[model samples]
Target chain A: MTPSSGASARTQPLDHKEIVAAPRTLVLVGNPNVGKSVLFGALTGKYVTVSNYPGTTVEVTRGAAEIGGLRWHVLDTPGTNNLLPMSEDEQVTRDILLREPEYVCLQVCDAKNLRRGLLLACQLAEAGVPFTLALNMADEAAARGIRIDTDRLSGALGIDVVSTVAVQRTGLPLLLERIPEAGVSKFRPRYDAAIESALSELEPLLPAARLSRRSLGLMVLAGDDSLQPWLASGASAVRLERIEGIRRALASRYPESLRFVVARQRLAAADRLHDQVVTRGKASAGSALARRIGAWSTDPVKGIPVLLLVLAAAYLFVGVFGAKTLVDFLENTVFYDHVVPWTEAFLRFVVPAGAVQEFLVGPPGLPFRETSGFVIGKYGLVSMGLAYGMAIVLPIVATFFLSFSVLEDSGYLPRLAVMVNRVFKWMGLNGKAVLPMVLGLGCDTMATMTARIMETRKERVIVTLLLALAVPCSAQIAVIFAMLQGLSFAASLWFSAVIVLVLFLVGWLAARVIPGRGSDFVLELPPLRVPQLGNVLVKTLARMEWYLREALPLFVLGTLLLWVLDRTHMLGLVERAAAPVVVGILQLPEQSASAFILGFLRRDYAAAGLFQIYQPYMSTGTMTRVMEIQVTVALVTVTLFIPCIANFLMILKERGWKTGLAISAFVLPFAVGVGAAVNLLMRRFY
Target chain B: MPALVQRQERCPLCGMAFDAEGQGCRPSCPLATGCRVVCCPSCGYSFPQESGWAGKLKGWLDRRKEAGR
Candidate 1:
């Protein structure tokens, strides 16, 4: 049978004489954001009207235009990434192609990304559509040192190819002139013989449609269900069953999805076409600079120093500027010097002296008198919870988010993933896990959710366990640095060493135990462009908002729990219950038990509790060596403890209760065990 | 007309520096509609897309290139 004679004629072939006599429909089709609409406006001017495609919600714009004194109808279809009807929008584009086979297709493409555009061109070619390929945004390609030889590309495809900067109307005259000569691409994507035979069998049964029967058969073989409406309308049950049998026979031939197989063939054709016509020259100055930085960032040798500089810069900003400068001003000057006094006076005026007054303002003495603790007491909601949330944690989270956004915008995070892949491989994980691990520093709760990106359940569980046990959130880290900065730099070193050791030991053990294969390392290192200040500010503000929303209420709840524990005398009972572990083995003060317990509410809240203990040193002007060792042990234990309540709940949600509870069970005992060991070792050495 | 700036990003896997935001989604990806990740055109590895004013500025320059031509 001829190509057009079999089930291929889904619709009546347009009468050649009639098509030439009437006004032609020129359809503009492309991937999204590819300047299709701009070209539409430039070609048709003010003559466009948009309405939803019939039977679908996707809008298609139609207008009238005059090209070379011939009046033509122009239809600007919705942006479709593919012609295979993967979505309702794409289905509409495909439907239009099937309905009006005579319409001329103008395929607009991004000149900088030709392969993707060429993939669609391949699809159009298989459909037997007469089309012209317009390579848009030529200037961008040029700036990136990309030069596509349109003449050679045209020769390869045996179709007219015109390069146009549509926004500037550079090649409009030539493009318009070439449209009339549009012809089917001489190039075709070849499928396997089995698929070709299946197409022949299905072609006889398919009713006349605009798409070639071969393309329709390929869609059918690939299991596209979106064509059910059309199939139901035309095919008898016997024909449908035969088509299904053909599909099943084809499916048995491949181990992978036929869709993937077909796509691979098409892309291979695109790549071959690209190699013939595309050339790269020297990059422009800005792109060259970004490329150089991107190269240095992932180079194993150069990346080490770059990583150190980044860490140092983060410490200088968050620890020094944020915790020291911003926190000092907000807490000391704003809250302590003004707001506390104002709240006290207001409380004194509102209530008469009694038990009630004492509960609210703590007997009107020093802020930490430690009596009658409630709303205004030393550990009260206002005094400690709100102060810590707004004054201390806010600056820390703000600076951290600011720095993080810059790293993200500059595209350094993926390179970091590459650099760390080797180390991660030791733990049966790969570089891809680094995304969520870095994210865990911002907030373990969100990072636990992001662990879903890992390829296997085993990798997710390991990453989640590590994040819970070792990655201290930004607030906790900030408070740790602040507290340790006063004691000694070695204090911070001890804390880091202990956490790193715990992470590696646990990861190594878990990798051996976990039962799935880790995904291989693969990451895209985006160019290291200069981050825009505006984007960084917007992202920082967004993260700060998330911090306030997530952390503030937990702070208040933690403080209230503390107050209730004290009031019910449960605090003393628990402290006494853990006294042997708290004071005897760990060598921490009895009061330190309360901080460890509060850490279960929020890691940073517990860190803030430790901060309060060290604050008196500012006035006393000395940190005893014993206090330093105790502080170091406390920080390490808190860092390795079970994830905070929010993150625990997320783990339970994402990983299911069994694994989540198992992880929590493991971490609780492991953290204390490591803390006890660290205490003994440090005491012996220091 | 001024030369347009090409936002080239190198894929770590293949080292092809295509337009960072210009990569297209695979036909089968369900998240293709609103996902904020950019796929590498060469290797198909997805990374987070750059956001905010910088992406907007790059878009504006692309449009300017179209118009200037």
Candidate 2:
């Protein structure tokens, strides 16, 4: 029968009788965006219902087609990341397989992303599903330096396999002809003895259905909650209770999630299959540029120049464009020229003269009082907090986020990790830690949370300490860049050298002190592709929204705290107490002490305070090399100071209070000591 | 419905497909509707979710390649 006879027919769901009467049903399945729908459309013509699954909003489409003289019902299911459901769509896809056992599986896969596809294929094999593998996007895959030996993959899986460019409708006829050759995959995954025993126990309890008892048992072992309905339909109360007991017992054996353990095995199997069947080749002309860049990105010898280029670009974009250009316009032209003057005049008019107006906008005759401390004070909520958050930090972080999105989309971050892996080895960390370290530059709190990806507690602790101590967050980086951009490049270099030296010294010491060894880095590098601008813009906007939500309240709260401290006379006392260290040790101005104390509240806030004191000389329109050494020393000190309050809380949550407190205890004195040393040394040279 | 049929975005590093709505740093975020950072559900790598322009550009490139073929 010709499945491609016509495109005129509209798709309709097969009635129960027709589904039952059909010779066979071919179900199309794969991970999301693997061209399953396109393949389904190619085979079934225009007949389809691409809508939510029954009784749920997860998308699933079904249609009917004639194949090999038999009317076949086609079930186009939602893309499942894994065979066992992690989300609603995955759940719907899993349910379709369990409920419709008579269907033959037609697994569509992205040719360039074979490993992930094979992970699901392994699940299908374990489930005893008769299936054929279609490696879709064959052309695009070839362009991106990927090639798969289909016959080898077929031999390895003991199933029919075909490569198809589904969008172009190439290889469809051949794929159709091989549908009859579909069979239960011969490949079977081996599980640990505990998992095996658990499967056996569950096998006997499972009711006869479309799914294999082994598959169902594995799902049960993995703690799939959605399986309850299926179990309730056929399992007795006693049997269900026994299964739960078995599951709990199995779960108790491991500290980590058992699901990940099982997934790791499947991933290993997929890797082996990939090694046996896939090959890398030269990319086409369209992708040659991306391919070469992708290679250079991970190659240590070639990557340095690429990395430098990237850093220079970032500095120019965030420092010059965002911080200098945009911030100048917003702060000088918009806020200083319009908002501050307007707000001060309005407050002066509205509030009757006396203590209220004086306190609200700061006392008259106080220099910069119109812009400085209380809610309405010159440094108050609107002038200081809003101006800093909107005019300065926002543009810098927006540019940073945009750049980050570009790197992430181009698949360069992983390559950077690979290149940095050698250096990380000296710190007793594998390349995997690079992800969190890189993320720390964006937000240390988020990076600390992401530290869970590290296999060892020792690695996590070390990385956490490094993040809290040395990494200057995106906001802080913006402020530092804004401050230093006006000064000499030597100051920037000096600041960077100190941070890198301190990071290595601390990380090395932590590695020697920590009890455990780190695991080797084994990461897959993705093919490089052109970044999608709309996607980049979206990510930038989302990150900016997150920043605004997280930072604005803190800015306002910080202003309030400063006001309270000033009111309580505590600010003067603390400044006096800190004066000796600030003046003698660090050799910084007395006012710098306040910025150091505020640094604990928010790193960016402290940096903003520094910006107010040391902005580029207005007449020269540039920061003089004047006191450049002092500025560099101060920046380095703050960069290495104790974590911000938010970050400290995260450290406590992730690593417990003792470790958190210990990290802070160590970082504070170390930061001060380094600041003193840097100051003493710089004073001699500059 | 056609517009809802988004192009599949895969993590460049791990090769995992992204659920445009579900995966990423802030899934339930109010700003998530317009945000395109498609995080890999399997691996933690986040990549920008592709737009229609990318799809159209790819199609155009593919057509040119096909003509050469």
Candidate 3:
């Protein structure tokens, strides 16, 4: 049959009638974006039919091609990172593998990212699927100084392995010739004794399917609920219940999840195979320099200096220039000098002077307030909200985002993780925790969710706790930097030292208290390169936009809430109620109580409040020693304080109510106690 | 000839390429409904999906590369 004719007939669900009617199938499988479709196009020229897999949105494409003098039904399955399936697309891909009969698989892999590809390869091998490997993107791999010995790999896996650039049709003939020689790989990752025993017992209970019983058993062990349908179809309920019992029993034996243990073994096997066959050469000049710098940045001894240098640069740029210079120009020259006067004049002309005007701009000449008009009041939208969000926090965050983007785009962030891996070990976490922690610097709510990347619940909780307790988000950090600008370098050092100590102490304590094992760190580091200017700018702008959308509104809301409290005389009541902690313990002005109240809404908002209170002290360049100590204590306390409402909600969502509440319960008192202690210590020393 | 119809985005963090539209956030996430972040199915690394001028810039770059090729 012609390709289109075959495709038209076979594109629908492969029912029993069609399965019998169709020819033997050649299924294309691989990770997404690895040129699977391109390979499919190369195999079956010009005509194909695409249809959704029955009852699902996942599209499955089918066509016919003459390969090695035989008409083969070509099935292009969905791209999947894991055959076990995590998402709908991956589930569909796994389902195709489970359902298809008399099929030979063609596993397309990215040549540069061989380790990740081999993870799927290992899964296929475990499933006893007869497959041929195509290491696509050979040219890109070569460009990046990566080389693979296909012959050695083929020998190792006992299967055909061909290096091809599918887009260029580089090794099409060779791949075509090897298609008929596809064979089941003998490779099997060695699991732990407990898991092996469970698998051995479970295998006999499972009914035969396209995949081996051992593979099915492993899937069960990994808690892959997507396999429920296939398992239900084959195994008796009694057998399934017994399988669950075995899974639970095995799970209880290990501190970590069984899925992590299984994945770790597979990753270990892939790494060994990779080491055996892959070699590196000199890359292009730019990348070569980057590679050298990347190496130095991850080195134990050298990495410290590199990290310190980067930090100093960031401090000077963000703290000195952005906070001091940009903020001065914006706040003084832009807002105080021009915008405030123009806005007050405009509001006076537009609206009759009364409560509405006072509410909008704030009462004229209010005590301790900088400008006149309600909008320029202590809680005015224009004076406090817009000034803090646009002028003070914006410049600081923008600069931070710029520096952070450069670090991220240059591929230094992962290396920073590696450098800190030893320290993370103390916390029962691997270097992988750094990704979320680093992300916490951007936004803790997102980072709390990203903590799912950790292998164990223990590590996730620890990471989340650290994120909530100490890792101030970007805007908060910017405000902190601005606050610190008024203090001595020693004060900054004290704040850093205390936060670091708290992080390690809490992490160490939580690791011991929480019950689970940490996974081995096995992150694949991308080749370092100079940060692209366009990419950095795009990332920075994107982050700035996020701040504008997600955070700026909170500033306005906070100002409005504060304004209402002030107007209702509730501000005095609340300030008096919080006096013991804010004034007595933290030794801050009674006015700083409002900042603490606002801190719960958003950490940056509170910091900005303190910044507003400290502004007079900073601008005059005449901050008293007592004022310096108070600012230091307040900044440190806020940094270690309870996370903002959004992050708290996220923590509750991710960790569930009990753990989330427990975290908050511990953090609140701990933050106040730390602040108190710092108050006493700074008083004694400084 | 299988028609290549779907577009994919590679996760910069984990290098796992996925169909951005198909990879939904966890159902329980409060921000799930209207979140603009594209989460990696494999690694769970969430990043804002590129759009507007950023997307245009990337498209322009890709087209330039294609034209050169």
Candidate 4:
């Protein structure tokens, strides 16, 4: 999506010939996660990309619905704030609007937070688009006893207003019914006379314009870059210079950025409309709660303690419960005892020959040839994939997601973001970046993708570094849980101390070394509320559906690759090569290197290696507890050290390969060196 | 009790506000409105409202799926 100051506007109608022979198109636009997808689903039915993440629909999603024998083309856009865009997603929103569709715009807003979203609504209104305001999440406001007067709102804004709860499909059909009516009229901004005069003169210079002349004039007035192509295309060198001259002359009279001023005026218009339409209901319980919690979560004494408690709760849930309890239950009860054994025996029964059975289950004298099964064994990708999915990872994440949902819904997470903003800033990120960090703890794969929410590319890379190095998603957290399970609470303390110290030190260092920028913290802390049980459930389900859909296929592919490696004995060859690095440099056994490979496949698998081998050593006194701490630190560091494949791919996609490779080259050696030094120090310091 | 939370007697750590009639709705949930132990937005604070047990059931199901995968 185009950033507001950079995007040039070309007002153009969509070509009917280019479109399939469908009826006129209706486009839905809104701020992020304001139920645009749900509305699309409601209107178009069942087929929308109904995932829980923001920016999930990276492109405009088009669907069709037949109403009164006419097939309606529905375009659902990514969430965006202003007509002038920032962020890639916002630019996509601009592109869709640039293609003038026939149906009126379904300008959706979260009714509870009209003040923030209405800023965009006002921009669209000023852009002279034919539109209707689709008020969403009305039930949320109504629960606070807030009432909105739709008729009054429509009159004030000069557009149709439809109050809806998209999840319930509430007022959706009514909106579809009113689309044809709202399509007949258009709205435009009223700029000051000086600006209008300049716009009128400049409008004639823009070529092949699809928008109103005033809109192009305003964009030229805004000094947006999107107009660069349009300006450069037709004008000769001299004409282009003349047009550029006009842009500069006009930029001067409007000393206040034209974008910002235009936005403020438009927001004021929306505010005026809101004032006319919304009543000051009895003080909402939600608003009151927001005020109260806002004090404590922000105040240092109570806020810091509260923040600690939250971190502790999260650690316990994702680390201890998800990793230890769930992993043990699934790996022990389900996969190890029932599924794997059953599959091995079934293979023995069917294969009919000793070598084949051994090949299917295991080679000579191993309890079960891990390589033998058709579905999951060393050779079977599907079985192993399902086993890993259900057995090793599922239970822990269930508890983790449930707890995560509760925290998110209660509004504590946003407050936590504000509290940590200062510390994170030293790492070159703002408070808003904390959301991704918290998410990084649960799953860095998802968190890395979420870092795009940060305003700048530089901030995004910094967050990515911290996520790759310091944060351990639920899977790795579980491995940590298992390692320290029987160790003294003091071990837990030591383990945590080093990780936290590293998190801050590495973040500070990366921020300084990476030469990135950071934003000042001023987050919109949403009112804390009792998390809704139902909302959390559906939301969690949607998120899981998204995770499983993205994750399982990778697991299968990873397993298939592993099978190929094992079959060719290439794993043996690679293992031998990695063993020396593991033993000679990290001072661990050759076997430990395989854990790193597993770490790439599934996050915590590397840490699980320590669990299997190290327990016997410390218990037998050949290995000291201090040694355990050192290795644990190293494994944790390395596990958090490199970007997981999923996150790495996202970075390559978003930041491009040069940045992605540079990040990896820097982090890999840093992880290994940190591990070696921390090992050496623990042996000395303790 | 910050006045905002005290007027509503909610756990400020988790903001959960509801009108009087909306009482007794998410009784069993740890983050439910009346828990007042942490911040909680209302079931009403929802695009996907947890109107009843359906919400809790979904959360449970999601967790289970998460564990399995």
* Per-residue lDDT over A190-297 for candidate 4, one digit per residue giving the tens place of the 0 to 100 score: 667666677777767766544555665666666667666666876678766666777677668753456645654555565566656666464545665565776688
Q: In order, what lDDT does every prediction score? A: 0.75, 0.75, 0.80, 0.62
Candidate 3 local lDDT, B1-69, one digit each (tens): 111123566666765656676564455655444455666766666666555555666677778767976
RMSD of each: 11.5, 11.1, 7.7, 13.8
Q: Best-fitting candidate, measured by TM-score? A: 3
TM-score of 4: 0.59
| Tens digits of per-residue lDDT for model 2, A1-686 | 33443322335655545644667889899977788888888877765556667789877666777776668878888877687775677888888888874778899998878987888899999898999999998998887668788888898899999888998988877788778669999998888888888878778988877877888888888877889888888989998999899988988986535675577566667877887887776433456577678878877799999999988997788778887898889988998788876877788789887888877776665544433436556458767878877877787777877887787767787788878877887898867778878777777766676676565789889999999999888778878877766677676777888899999999999999988866545455666777766556655565555556556777788777777877898888888899998878888888878888788888778877777777646236655454677788788888887547778877877788898899999998888899888887777775
**What does candidate 2 score on TM?**
0.62
Runs of candidate 3 with Cα error greater than 4 angstroms are A1-29, A32-105, A111-115, A118-131, A135-177, A183-285, A363-373, A618-626, A684-686, B1-7, B27-32, B56-69
Alpha-carbon DockQ of candidate 3? 0.29
- Give lDDT tens digits, candidate 2, residues B1-69: 011224455555565654455554442323223344455555555444433444455566658767986
Write down the worst ten-residue block by lDDT for model 4 chain A: A1-10
DockQ of 2: 0.19
TM-score, one value per model: 0.63, 0.62, 0.73, 0.59
Query: 1 or 2, which is superior by DockQ?
Result: 2
- Which candidate should be chosen as best, given DockQ against the real structure? 3
Q: What lDDT tens digits, residue by residue, belong to model 1 across residues A1-686?
A: 11111111112323334333447788889876667888887877765567788877888887766665666677888876678765577888888888874688999998876877888898888888889999998987887688999999898888999888988978877888887678988878887788778888889988768777778877887778888778878899899999889888888897545765677567667777886898776433476577667778777789899889988998899878987999889988998788766887788789888888877777765553364557667777777877788888788888887888788767788788767777887888877777778777877765676676576789989999999999988878767767777677776688788888888988999999988866544333444677766656655664555456567778888999998898899999988988998898889989888888898998777777777787688347688888888888888888887657878877877688899999999998888888899899889886
Better of 1 and 4 by DockQ: 1
Candidate 3 lDDT by residue in tens digits, A1-686: 11222212223344334433446689999977788999898877755778898879998988777676766778899877777665678888888888877899999998978988998999999999999999999998887678899999999898999999998988877887788779999988898788899999999988899998888889889888888887898888998899999999999997555765788678778878987898877444565577678889888898999999988998898878887899889988998788877887787678777787766665555431643334776677777789888988788778887888788777787788878877898888977898888778777877787788776778889998999999988778778877787888888888888899999999999889988767655555666877778778777776676556667777888888887787788989999999999998889999899889998898778888898888887978998889888888888888887657888888988899999999999998898899889889989997
